[model samples]
Target: MVLDTVMTTLHVLTGALWVGSVVFVAGVVLPAALDGSLDAAPLETFADRLVYGSRAASVVMFLTGGHMAGTGYTFDLLLNSSRGHLVLAMLLLWLVLSALVEIGRSRLVEGLQEKRVRSPARNAMGVFRAAAVVGVLLLVDAGLLASDVALY
Candidate 1:
């Protein structure tokens, strides 16, 4: 029971951090940088700092979530139960989010490294928008999953 509680807490906290960071970067940081309100250097620096934390949180969430799923539900339950369906949806969302973050970051960093000063912001904005939309969707799915679990 204690282990379950701890894993649940970790899973929720890490998930929140991962999603919050993405939203902040996509909605606030990218816009500010593009508009010239925030300088590119500082924005890049801030993003660099966030990358490690975001990735770490993502990994932790995946690990804890997987552990919880494995221990709490059988394969039959996963396929047949409503909660299982929700979990599967959440998992798919998580995979997409992970891909978006990685691909976006890679493109952003590549542009930065290439010193594409004139276009990096514009390019990054597109990636940020894409990631942000997916992140928001993931958050909604998570909320629904939590609500379903609570009612269960």
Candidate 2:
């Protein structure tokens, strides 16, 4: 019970941090990057900050989730448990985040390289915003999952 509680706490904290990062990147940084003057150094710095933070949060989230998966709950039980839904939601968020990092950041860098401040920034910002909204929804669903032993 105590271990479970710890794992749950860690999991929730990881999710919160990840979602919060997503929101900050999408809502704040993205817009700022889009509007501000696009210098390669500055854009690279901003992208580095976002990427580092995201990777850290992603690590924690993965660890806590992996811990849960390694517990007494068999694969089938987890697949059928409330944890399952939360895992799926986490996966969806991960996919969006990974895609954003891969495509969006690279595109942002390319935009910086080519000095197309408006379109590339706007497009990257749009991707971030879309990811943020979905991440928020999935995080909420994970919270709901935390509160219940069964979500389906």
Please, what are the lDDT tens digits per residue for candidate 2 over residues 1-152? 89878987987886677677768877776677667745556766777777776777677777777787677457786678766757666677776775676566776777776765666677787777776787788677776776775645
Report the Cα lDDT for residue 30, model 1.
72
Candidate 1 structure quality by residue, lDDT tens digits, 1-152: 99999998898878877888888888877776566676556656776776777678778978998999999889998888887887788788788777777766666666666544335667766776777787788778778877776332
Deviation (Å) of 34 in candidate 1: 0.8
Candidate 1: list runs displaced more than 4 Å: 114-118, 149-152
Specify the highest-TM-score model's number.
1
Model number with the top lDDT: 1
In model 2, which runs have C-alpha deviations exceeding 4 angstroms? Answer: 1-6, 37-40, 149-152
lDDT of 2 at 38: 51
